[model samples]
Target: MGLLFILLLGVAIHWASAAKLGVVQTEGGQVKGKNVKVSLLFRSVDVFKGVPFADVPGMWEKPKPHPGWDGVMRADTYRDRCLQVTLLQKKTRGSEDCLYLNIFVPQGRKLSTNLPVMVYLYGGAFLLGASNDMSFLGVSLYDGKEMADRGGVIVVTVNYRVGPLGFLSSGDARLPGNYALWDQHAAISWVRRNIAGFGGNPDNITLFGQSAGAASVSFQMLSPHSKGLFRRAISQGGVALSPWALQKNPMALTKKIAMKVGCWRMNEDVMIKCLKMSDPVKLTMAGKIDVLLILGKGTVMDLIEFSPVIDGDFIPDEPSKLFHNAAEFDFMAGVNSMDGHIFAGVDVPSINSKTANTTVKSVRGLLAGLTKEKGGAAVESAFSVYSSNWGSHPDPAVIKKTVADIETDFLFLVPTQIALQLHANNASGARTFSYLFSMKTRIPGFPSWVQAEHAEELQYLFGKPFSMPLIYFPRHRDLSKYMIAYWTNFARTGDPSIGESSVPAVWPAFTENRRVYLDINHKISKTSVSSDLRSYYVSYWTETYSLLPSTRQTGVLRAGDLSPPRGRPESSARET
Candidate 1:
């Protein structure tokens, strides 16, 4: 009996030794990860969850490298997510000890292996999001394992601070904001130093994200702080050029929170100290943040409150001006068909119930005020360009649809186009590609016209339909495969079509003269290769609005003054 037990213990020790890593260990210690078999690909991948990549700094301070520790930290489970408010701010979950990141490496790799690495950042309007096993209908929305297996690369999903804890700034030396940006920067630095331990090629890293995460990828590309951390970038449905990407008044939320917590003092430094000592849960729900764009007549636009601001150190200047180094990056960006449903549905609520043209009346008044500022011709030209031409007594549903289209054009479509053009021009043939995801995948219960809403393409890219086959249609599986291939290919090589995997259609590069983009819609088909989508409207925004007294340096163009207004979305962007 003793001999049999000794033999079993020796075999267990042998298997453990085989899995042990070399000199590339986390700051805390060595991590013990599990080998998860990806059923769809019939392959297994090594996953290390809750790895402490950095030790986040205090209340409003920047993050630093994690101090080394004594022994193995056991990274098999997800650590606490950064403290955040959820369930309508009625309750809160997560903790300040939440600077952990999850790493996924493809199986059959060794110390000598040199695979490409992709770091993912989640988007919650910079208010709320997590990198820990996000799922709906049994689909892991942001699983890095699926990408690792499909792309044959190493994948990293990082957790950065959000909301007041992450972005509160006084626009001064006392309380500089952008702690979240520092968190992301530190994570990338950690990858550059430590990813080689897992057989990852640190020199060939790709940064990709959706919405605010996509905006962060843009920041990472443009900011001098992230100069040599990454070489490639992809932004989907969002970019730093979007009006909501930068904060107008970084100090407003700080004041509100200080008042609620009874920490309101004359000095900013004193306020920071009080905030650090308060209960984190109370801190989460304390402040009532009134977001951006108060137009003429005190009309507030729909925009997120907690986003990065110009601390003059991290951001340095306006987003548009920072693209001078664009030639160094291989860039890809695009938008969804109805990305603005999140804004319009709230701005024009329950079309049938609010049938008295209540929403329309408010919008018209808002337009009149805006035209008053710019000119009467502004409203005239806007209506001329976007005239639905619906006869009297038009369906309220149609009115809501029009609002959605208007929002989509201003917020998602045009901003993405301007950004694509900027990168393509500056890249000087370094391979920039753009695409529009128009897959007829509308949110359930939303109006039929609201097709391909924002963040819908993410699931397909993350391989949700493949994992939950019974819940989706066959077309979904096909699209998911194509997206995974294209994305991983971009991460591996500078070009999307030059890799081991095969994609359905060859994705073309975007250039100034070509003005090309790939339209990815499997259900309702369009020409695979297209050019300058909606040129007339694009011209309307780029030409007419460029004349307005807007500052790209500040990134503060109100949707109403620049175009048309339909801005509220905190109650709406989350439903879908």
Candidate 2:
């Protein structure tokens, strides 16, 4: 009798565990997932972690769909991250076999079908990141439980290759890089085909990402290979138009890596074969891999060591040339008000430098390296625009913001503005919404003076306030709720405000003439926005800097307009 009671207890425990988990059949086979509870409202979501969407890829080869599994593949755990170095450059972790996707489905009595699907791609300058919830800084970087629950959509996060393993290309057929992009393509294709089994609408999938992921989404919007794959697209903080998005003279960078891996040879086939078999760790650590001995030195092309290549197929032309037309899909993109903080902060003496000189000389040395022959002239011209209003002895905070403003405009602000304008002009009627995320972050690392530094919007957009209620104020929760509504509403009907009264104001569609853009902050309203939208800075970069002889000689794009300031008027900004 005692043994029978013990056996009954064991069965009961197993039943309870099963009740908290869910099973779904995929094209590959059956898989089990964890049932997670989210939000104060207490909704359950089945989160399938580390489900293989594509098989392990060979070096420089496109990915293939995962072979059908034999039986119920236990997918309750996150997969290994793709190989990458940490942001601090203090540590390294991950593996070559890291191509997996995590899917989150809102649990219900019957099948949860016909729900909109959102597939996310993370960004780390195309160098590092993972799809696991506990990925970045040991926090929930890619958790979709709350998003799936709150938005009533199927949320899928993907793990694509980064670093040399993902982006090193030979600039030819031998090794046309962008293996990471292909991995993204495979993951999306798999989702389009198999998401119905997970109770999602395969037809209404929205692809969105931040940083490199955003650039990847923009690339897909132009690539023929990605046609008919997604209905809506969103990019945050990065795009193909950014200086670091495409790897110019990739052949030179590839050859450098080849030599580092001891794979150099006269024959391209032999060189590639050796690289395939070389140690991945050694290849990744090709030391200072961010930009070393390369032909495109002293130019914007060398900003990032490895990135997507225009291999004639995936990206047939330069991104600027291709922006004349785009996919027939609604689009949304924005940048943090201080999006350049991370990049420009490294050069400036930081908040600690109380009496530092915020002059052209401080930035001239760096611009010389990036702008090459025209570095000095470029600095003078840009300084005239960027530091126009600074009274030479500006406060350190103001100085820091001014420095960050240059990077913000060059790397993110202007590029995003141009992208929105191009998409607006290209679209027949497809809508494009642009915004500037000015909401400050609650995360403590950033100096209080910094407003909406890069990726600050992610936490609010992903419902972080809902998860860590104690750490956030009531205002954060309210802001997060409205953001989710706008994002999900856009995914569902291509409009952020369609009967959603929670939104503070009507988001006007950006056009070439009006150039309307939302300034998202404590008060979210059209009345708070500028109609001309960075008109002065637009003229400074596009007209003054772009037409300069330096820009022409450097072979860089006409990145700036005639506006004295990068995006705002001299009276409003530090730059003239």
**Native-to-model Cα distance after best TM-score fit, residue 62 in candidate 2, in Å:** 0.3
TM-scores for every predicted model: 0.85, 0.89
User: How many clashes show up in model 2?
Assistant: 22
Report the C-alpha displacement of residue 212, candidate 2, in angstroms. Answer: 1.0
Best by lDDT: 2
RMSD of each: 6.6, 5.2
Identify the leading candidate in terms of TM-score.
2
**Mind giving the per-residue lDDT tens digits that candidate 2 earns over 1-576?**
999999788655544433243567888889998776543233468889899998887767898867777878889888998887766666678887889999988764344778899999998778878887344445575788777878888899999988888999888888888899999999999999989888889889999999888999888777778777888899999888787798878877877788887989988788888887888887777623453323334433355677898989888887766764464778899888888877665554553244554555666644555455465677677766666666767665666677777777777877777777778777866788887778875656666567777888888888888877777888888778877878888888888776333577777777666676777766676574555556676666667767667533333236532122334463321232
lDDT of 1 by residue, 352-408 (tens): 243355356655544443344455556656665555444667566666666666667
Model 2 misplaced stretches (Cα beyond 4 Å)? 1-21, 40-42, 87-91, 108-110, 133-139, 266-270, 287-303, 350-352, 355-359, 392-396, 443-448, 499-501, 550-556, 559-576
Deviation (Å) of 456 in candidate 2: 1.3
* Separate clash counts for every candidate: 1, 22
TM-score of 1: 0.85
